[model samples]
Target: MMNDVDPQILARYAPRPGRHALLPSLTPQQQVALLCRVLHREGYNDHIAGHITLRQEDGTYLANPWELTWAEVKGSDILRLDAQGKIIEGEWNITPAINLHIDVHSARHDVSVVIHNHSEWGSVWSAVGRVPPIYDQTSALVDTDPVCYDEYRGTVEDSELGRAAADALGEHKWALLANHGVLVVANGIRQAHLRAITLEWRCRMAWRVNLLGGGVPLPAAVAQATGQRTDASGFPFLWEAMARDEIRRDPSVLE
Candidate 1:
């Protein structure tokens, strides 16, 4: 007997592999660099004003250095750093402001990746110092309404500011750094990248709605259901496609 497949189950299942699919073989550096380039094309590049870090099993972090633009990140450019933010590998320096990533890692052991960037639309909402409404269904791909850290304390060069930002983020998957940018934390790189991209999308749409002066909220129950479905995504379909696209554009990114 053939039973109708539950759509929910499908959402939670892995997608069939494409011709170039090879998820598990990718290294931490390669993953982080790929994320940078993917987001870079999405307008997340603000000079060298962003950082993406992946946590290691023993609490060290793999991060992009202060020298390279996200658009030009290659796997070889990733630096390994100790818990105390000391460089353990690679020949480049980390920003003292990396305390933001370090503190978030310290506070959330479940988080595998932390991405912060002064992205275009996200910065527009950040300047407004409020959580933008979830106008598009795609925007709800992120966890609910992102909380706002409606305070700017310069560039987070010290642990104090970083810890404060992490505290503000609480358990939310992403937060808007008012007058600055966005911070996203996820259990894996794929979810983190998706959240970062969707955060920008939501901000962009919200701005359009604001400019036109008409915006309607999705019912709370409907919005919650959408978020649950989006969160249930199991495979790396979005990340895998974006990554492969970047690789096709610049093979050097893998080196």
Candidate 2:
């Protein structure tokens, strides 16, 4: 067995500078590619209306430039933005949803990754106002009633709107933007993407099950236990495995 090195030593080697990288360690390029694959696989390109973002090593954020579809999105399309939503790097127009991104990232330190998508299933479930509780082990991916509603009156143009939306999400991992779509967040890009995918899966299942004469949902205790054990490896290992494969197969994704 390896002798345990001082935990402090390991900590100091983290992504940020000598402070041991208080922030996550993803490069701008990696953040972009992961965003692309996340949207691509989830079919968020249908309207090309979704976006993903990750905090860079310097506490800045990497997000997709406006109008870039998930499939056509290259890593070069990723724009670096400062805390005030000003572009710090890259050559692309910023999207209006930048405020939503900035508000959430600034408000929640636990969230290093954020994905906003208007998918068929996620949107469909959100349209219903009330999101049903966990219906299965997979549904428990939400963990502690993850879904919230915004009652979307219009685009989130102000910090108040964004804050309200974020508030609806509370401390949960996911939320439903009423009349708009869904947002998923996590401490890492891969984990956020995984939560987004799983949230949609859970939504789809809820819809299907509801069709069969209103199927029974999982017990609360079961959901709690399932959610607790779901991340035994500390992250969505399976989703990260696939994400790593995606990057491996298409190195150009980082171009």
Candidate 3:
């Protein structure tokens, strides 16, 4: 499967044909530009608390520079880090969760995008350490069993803790960092963002249901049947497009 690539030591996986390419290869700046749009759109910039990362074809990862508000972030502000969490480019430092992202990406090569955020509903759900399955088409996120829950112990400060959280992911595309926030891992930025959005919505729905005298959880067989669900194109095109439009129209989200 790893063919048609450069002869360099890290050039094992070939870029898919027909996919867009960056002539000079994407710099950390361009990656940050797209990430600013994502962060601004996702409303995860609350006090500068969330991050998004893209694994480049060169085996390095690009992410937002530490300590910058999502809105204030420019394309030139992204930081590129290697597998060992060493910075290769950019001036800002990496966030504590940076190692967590590196760990997950190292363990799951299929996951090219990683997003961590302390979203509203996600934070609420994480505090309790529970995330129920789908109750609607949007909940189809859990359809493929993409959501995982990790109990809160302490802050994720070291590579070991990050690796442990990655293990909790267990092949799922998303996971709730208990008493903390949410993490989304997918093959593309759109897919990862979609998962994060849907996860927040699901958690909100569950929170509401719980408030109104509690709600019944889905049956095991029903959840399993739901998990069998899949998109014909392996993606939810309409939903993704619509969400992007809304985000673009109102980019000053957290402002």
Candidate 4:
């Protein structure tokens, strides 16, 4: 028998920060490597065109090396760069385009992790010069509709272009990189990883729906409520499950 529920009691059921207790017991380097392998499996691999960076306690950063594809990256291959962007560790080089991460980190103090990839489906949407309307419920996992950097000033090879893209991203956690790819930012590994995967899936589904003559999206109030439920903690349990697949596929990533 259903009865009137107490609002305070109902609030207790909502997602909380420490609710997902199954966190990966790995170092930051190992975590980054595992996420790269997982993202590669999830279609974020695009030769050597993608990058993931984690800002460190000393204000330096740890990023993937440039010579290898995201799939081939391991903990040992991760690089540490000084705040000046010079490689202070690792046997390989970090991409110059990492300036994009630098700029975003500067612009948004809340972001501790930044991921950029020229993924297949995401690239397709990037060419459209605008965000695809959210038609599916899962796409609502994002904080908001991504800001599109439509100026298309070529590759983000310099600080100026990086700043422009970051400016377009503004306060949003996601962005469509004009004629390029996608950018996802968050304060944790789980959030950033999940957002990247969700952003790509959102674009993939949106395009498919558009081809099918399109359908109506969830109402703003409903979608916003859904996002509130899903966005909290970025579904850490899902991250643990997906990360397990990567760990089982190659145990050496923990190196």
Best by lDDT: 1
| Tens-digit lDDT track of model 3 for 1-255 | 111112452243335678543222334355445545554555465667767788889898888877887667766677788877778998887788788888888888988888887877777777777675455556554455544556566666666777788889878878878878888787765456556666776777777877787766666667556535432122334333443454456543222
Alpha-carbon deviation at 160 in model 2, angstroms: 3.5
For candidate 3, the lDDT comes to 0.65
Q: What lDDT tens digits, residue by residue, belong to model 4 across residues 49-128? A: 87899999899998998998988788888999887678999899878898888898888889989998898788888988
lDDT per residue, candidate 1, 191-254, as tens digits? 7777888888888888999899968966777777877766645223666678878888998988
Question: Residue 132 of candidate 3: its Cα lDDT?
Answer: 51
Q: Name the regions of candidate 1 deviating beyond 4 angstroms.
A: 1-24, 232-236
Model 4 scores worst on lDDT over the 10 consecutive residues at 1-10
- The alpha-carbon lDDT assigned to residue 17 of candidate 4 equals 71
- Give the TM-score of each candidate: 0.90, 0.81, 0.73, 0.89
List pairs with backbone clashes in candidate 2: 16-21
The model with the greatest TM-score is 1
Worst 10 residues of 3 by lDDT: 1-10
Error at 136, model 4, angstroms:
2.0
Stretches of model 3 off by over 4 angstroms after superposition: 1-43, 145-151, 215-255
Q: Write the per-residue lDDT of candidate 2 for residues 1-255, one digit (tens) a residue.
A: 001223443465333655432223446576666657755676565566766888877888888877777766777778888977788998887777778888888888988888877877888867776676567777775456656685676776566787778777777778888887888887765456557767777887888888886777888887877766543223324544555667766767666
For all candidates, the clash counts are 0, 1, 1, 0
Give the TM-score (vs. native) of candidate 1: 0.90
